[model samples]
Every structure is written in structure tokens, then in C-alpha cells.
Target: MRESRFIAVKLISVLKPVIDRRRRLALIVDDTLMARSCSKKTELLAKVYDHDKHEVLTGYRGLTVGWSDGNTFLPVNFALMSTKKKENMIGNQPVTADQRSIAGRRRTQAQRPMNAVTVELLKQTKKVYYRYRDRLYDVKGLYERLAAAKTRQ
Candidate 1:
């Protein structure tokens, strides 16, 4: 995750020159299903609802947040989400890593609700691109969840 952030920071620097300063920038958030239908043993694999297909499927939900200036779009950060429900989970192995370690934290994040993860992603993005603090748009219904996550911290 640290490596990915480093790369994203560098990419932003490279793209900054091309992005028009006059136009409004947007912090886009969305999720998509990464289907793994054939693999039953994949770690953290779970039953995720595919919005496009309108059905539950065996896979991970790729929750992503990106930056765009109307024309150019650059993905800033993402989390692979997994179902927390015991019955919906497919390959739910015990995470043996230390809770403070990246792998353990990532596993914990995967099981969290999408709104929580989205808040975290946005916070991380804010840290990376501090200049665009005002540009981070809150998705409808997420303000309450964001406040809850902050109080827990």
C-alpha cells in the first residue's frame, strides 16, 4: 500500500501540469466486482453483489477513489472489499499477521463496511494531495458514517 501511494503521488505530480487549473476537479468514488468464479480457495474471497449484473457473485469488491479534472482521470487509492458475513465468505482464513502490520490492517479493512473504507480512502488521499483539500467531495449519505469513524479513532 505504501508503494502504491508513492506511485500515485508521483503520477499526480506528472499529471498536474496537464490538468487545467480553471476547471473544477473531482474526487470520484466507485466500486466494481472482481469476479473469481472458478477459484474457491482465493484468500478473502466472498459473495459480493455485482450492481451491473444485479446478482450476488463469488468475488471481491474493488472500492476505488480517483481524481479527475473533467478530462484526465487518475486513480488515487483503492481497497479490495470482502464480505463480513460468515455465510457469504468463501475463503475465510485466519489472519496470523500482527494487527499493526499492513497485511493485518488490510484484512481488517476488507471486512469493514464500504462507507468506512471509503472514508479511509478519502483521508489517505487528502494526506497525499494536501493541496486539493477542498476538492474532496463527500458522497451522499457518507457524512454520518465519516463522523462515526472519526469518533471511533
Candidate 2:
């Protein structure tokens, strides 16, 4: 049999069991910092900016979206966000939730893709999701999107 690049995966038909035992499997999304970059010899740090003051106010911050498999947490999404620049602090300063996007209304939006390792990890991560078929093929096309992002990288 010839080997195909993409696996012909079938959606499994099983509801997630509510087992109280620790052996119950769950999804785990994790991100590890490879390194950091800085100007001069300044110390590199992972800091989430202050949402109000819009400043890099020390300490590590990143978003990792996960899915609970009725037992444990499974990381399904992770985004490494760059610190928002304090640009135009005087013009349209302090953007609130209802505030419009700085880029303004859009007609044709850009398709920014994802990284490669994320793609491979996502590919290897789908086995946990087969139990979700009755909940709708909720994770459909996730792998393709991840692969596209890898190619973009």
C-alpha cells in the first residue's frame, strides 16, 4: 500500500467517560520558551503588558486555550503574543473593549499563518478529539490550518 502524506483519520464514536481515576486521559497544551532577544546586554524577560497603562510590566504572560476532556485539561490553542507597542498614546490612547480596531474597517483581511512545530504537534494531538464527534466535528480543519501556518513559516 502506498503511503499518503495526510492520514485518513476516522472520527471515533465514543462519548468521553467520566472516570474518577487518574488514569483518565486529558489534553495538555504547553509552550516552552526557546530563548529571548534584547537590545545591548539587557536581560531578556517574559512579561505581559499592562492592559491599561499599556506597558511591559514584568512577569511572564501568554495565552494557552485548552479543552477539558471531562477529566483533564487539553491544550488546543496557544498564541505567543508580542507586547503591544505604546504608539499613538496621545491620539487614540487607551483602547477599551468597545473601541474599534486601530487598523480600521477591513475589506480584504490578511491571512497570517502559524508555525511548523505547532503543526506537527497538532497533527499528533488529534487522537484525543475523536471522542468529540457527537459534539460536532468541532475541531474540523484545525490540522489543515495548522499545516498551512507551518508552510507559511
Candidate 3:
């Protein structure tokens, strides 16, 4: 994961010059369904709603945050959200990874609510790129958290 982040940062630096100076950078947050309907044993697989399809589906919600300047878009951070409710989960195998390991941490994070995970993705994005003129997130409580973060700094 750290390696991927490093690559994303490098990619951003390389692309920064190509972005139009007249346009402001914005943070965009959104989620999509990652269908794993056939897999019963996949880790963290859950029954998630597909807003586009307007129905429940067997999959994970891939929440992502990205940076965009009218012309170009670069993904900054993301989280795969899984339902914590046992009834909604399709895969319930216990996570055996050590708590300190990245895999374990990520597995734990997957079970958290989507809004909380989205906030975490925003925080991670903020660490990588500090300047953005606008934030495009639909989650409730996100503005409050970001404002609180700003006040702390």
C-alpha cells in the first residue's frame, strides 16, 4: 500500500505541470460496487446496495478520493467498505493476520461504516496534497470533520 501511495505521489508530481493553471484543484470522493457475486469465500465480501442499479448486490463498496483539475484526474486514496452486519455479510471468515500488519489493519478498516472510511481516505489525501480549492463529497459529517481538522492545524 505504501508503495502504491509513493507511485501515486510521483505520478501527481509528473502530471501537475500539465494541469491548466487557470483551473482550481478539487478533491472528489465517490464509491462504486465491486461485484464478487460468485465468490463465497472472498475476504470481506458483503451485501452492498448499488445506487445506480437500485438494488442490493453481493460485493464491496470501493470508496475513493481523488484530485482533479478540470482536465485531469488522479486517484489519491481509497477504501473497500464491507458491511459489519452479520446478516448482510457474505463472507465471515475470521481475519488471522497479526493486528500490526497492514493486511490486518486494512481488514479491520473494511468493516467500518462507509462515512468513517471516507473521512479516513480524505485525511490520507490531505497528507499527500495539502492544497485544494474545493472538496466534492456527499457524506454527512465530512464537512464538520474537515473543519475540525483545519481548526486543529
Give per-residue CA lDDT, model 2, range 1-153, as digits (tens). 011112222111122344444443444344333223332222223343455455654432233434454544434544442323334111222224332563321100111122333443344445434333211122324446655665777
lDDT computed for candidate 2: 0.34
**Cα deviation of 29, candidate 2, in Å:** 7.7
Pairs of colliding residues, candidate 2: 27-73, 27-74, 28-74, 29-75, 114-149
> Superposing every Cα of model 3 onto the true structure, what RMSD results?
3.0
Worst 10 residues of 1 by lDDT: 132-141
Tens digits of per-residue lDDT, candidate 3, 2-110, equal 5565677788788888877888888888777898878898877888877778899898887778788877777778887887788887886556646888788788888
Stretches of candidate 2 off by over 4 Å are: 1-15, 18-44, 50-53, 62-65, 69-121, 127-129, 133-153
Q: Which runs of model 1 end up more than 4 angstroms from their true locations?
A: 133-153
Task: List the candidates ranked by TM-score, beginning with the highest.
Answer: 3, 1, 2
From the highest lDDT down, the ranking of the candidates is: 1, 3, 2
- Candidates 2 and 3 compared: the better one by TM-score is 3
Please list the C-alpha lDDT of all candidates, in the order they appear: 0.78, 0.34, 0.77
